[model samples]
Target: MSMAGDGREPLPHGPDPEVNHSSIGSTSPERDPLTSLMEIRGSLMVFATVMASVTYRAGLNPPGGFWTDNIDGHKAGTPVFQDVYCTRYKIFHYFNTSSFMMSLFILLFAIKASINNSDITKIMLHLTVLMDVITLIVSYIVGAYEDFQSSTYALVLMLMVFIYLVLEATTLIVRLCKAIRQMAYVLAKI
Candidate 1:
């Protein structure tokens, strides 16, 4: 077979063994398996660290205090704490802290999946983290305002996050299965 000036050989009319298999340098250097895997893992780690820091801050510094103050002589009127101020602060603190922790855990799982090159697992982890953020925001808003409508929104967000977590877990399970299958296949071949 004669090679073209472009240094490329013409394709065979039938299936070729070389065509069916991959060569050492067929893939781009940037897309090298190890490099890609490491990049993904590094991204996941960064996300995890950010989330953990946020959660730690939120959890440690909750707002509002239940101090008793004297009012008008011996008689005291129990003025209900204003939701706009106290409630909002408390709600924000709770949501931020919870969101941070959830994001951290999800990021950890994402890193693990990236190490294995499991796209499905990484995507699921990201989705779960996104859901957590959504839920935290909704809950904080609901807590800030003493409105029935806002409460409903918070509940819906919570439900969505729960569902997403379950889905993410399922994806992780699938990734594990794939890993096991691959290992078995390799062993069998050997």
Candidate 2:
């Protein structure tokens, strides 16, 4: 068989017998940790912005509309849903407000950190983001409580995912700490 004289590199037909195929793409530079952190920060910012907007809208225009007149102890402009389903409404309101506040805090801290290059505030940013997500989920579940079965399923799934994330985060933190300590010791020996 004759090889084509095209002015292009030949594609790999198969793994070369004399080459280590596993390391073929390993020569590229590793991603910088700072870049990864910045990416995560950007994502958190976007999520916070979205959650804030949604919760703000929900707060302004609650489900079931508002009471039009101050009659029978129901204040005008108060949510009718609150008067009807008091407990559920309170849960939803509290969670929604909490989510909104948390998102606002995340946004504030993210912006401040970015402007000032503050590493200390990043910890709070992470916690705020987590809380915002949790409250948002709780708010959704409460707001949609008319369907009990679906709410139950969502609650179960949310709890499972939260537990899994916590466990994985803990494991990752431990491994990272170990790696850093080992690297420090190695550098010390050199």
Candidate 3:
């Protein structure tokens, strides 16, 4: 017999003999990337929905007597609601809402990309969502509290929100730049 065929050497065996173990438990299901992405997207969507509703209610109905005169007989010129800056406030509020909606869309897109195993896109989407959250919080604080200009406490809160907005936006921009670089690298590799 030829050594290459019928004369081949037998396979080596371990010290212990193998035994059937079908009764043993199997491993748990692996973590699905889509599941994690969907969870994050769902959380972001819920937050956006709540913020949108609150913004709409505040814009449309407002509160009873939002422009009422003080008991000290000082008619504050129709309050902050009637001030010229009210237009600016409304514009900013609209921007905040639009940004949040856009971020939600980006998050959905990112989820799809993540399902396809794209990391850069997912990071960019997360950064976008974070930016939207920061903007929403700042705008909501500014829009909800008209006493920011009068009350020291409110003014401090406003300042803090403003600072947060700036910081978050800066960080998001940096992340976006990094993501773009990563995408370029991935594309070049392909």
- Candidate that scores best on TM-score: 2
Q: RMSD to native for every prediction?
A: 9.7, 6.5, 12.7
Local distance difference test values of all predictions, in order: 0.58, 0.73, 0.59
After superposing candidate 1 on the true structure, give the runs of residues whose Cα lies further than 4 Å from its correct spot: 1-30, 63-150, 188-190
Stretches of model 3 off by over 4 angstroms after superposition: 1-31, 62-86, 89-93, 103-117, 145-149
Give the distance in Å from residue 83's predicted Cα in candidate 1 to where it truly belongs: 19
What tens-digit string does per-residue lDDT give for candidate 2 at 30-59?
A: 544354356567777788899999999998
Predicted candidate 3 versus true structure: per-residue lDDT over 84-140, tens digit per residue: 366656655565666557655654564454454345555666566666666666666
**Model 3 worst lDDT window (10 residues):** 20-29
Q: For model 2, give the 10-residue run with minimal summed lDDT.
A: 114-123
Candidate 3 backbone collisions, by pair: none
**Cα lDDT of model 1 by residue, 1-190, tens digit:** 6556878777777667665344434545445565544655666677667767655654553333332456432222322332325555555665676677678776666556435545544455555566566656554454444566757776676667767766776676777677678878989999
Task: Score every model by TM-score.
Answer: 0.41, 0.60, 0.54
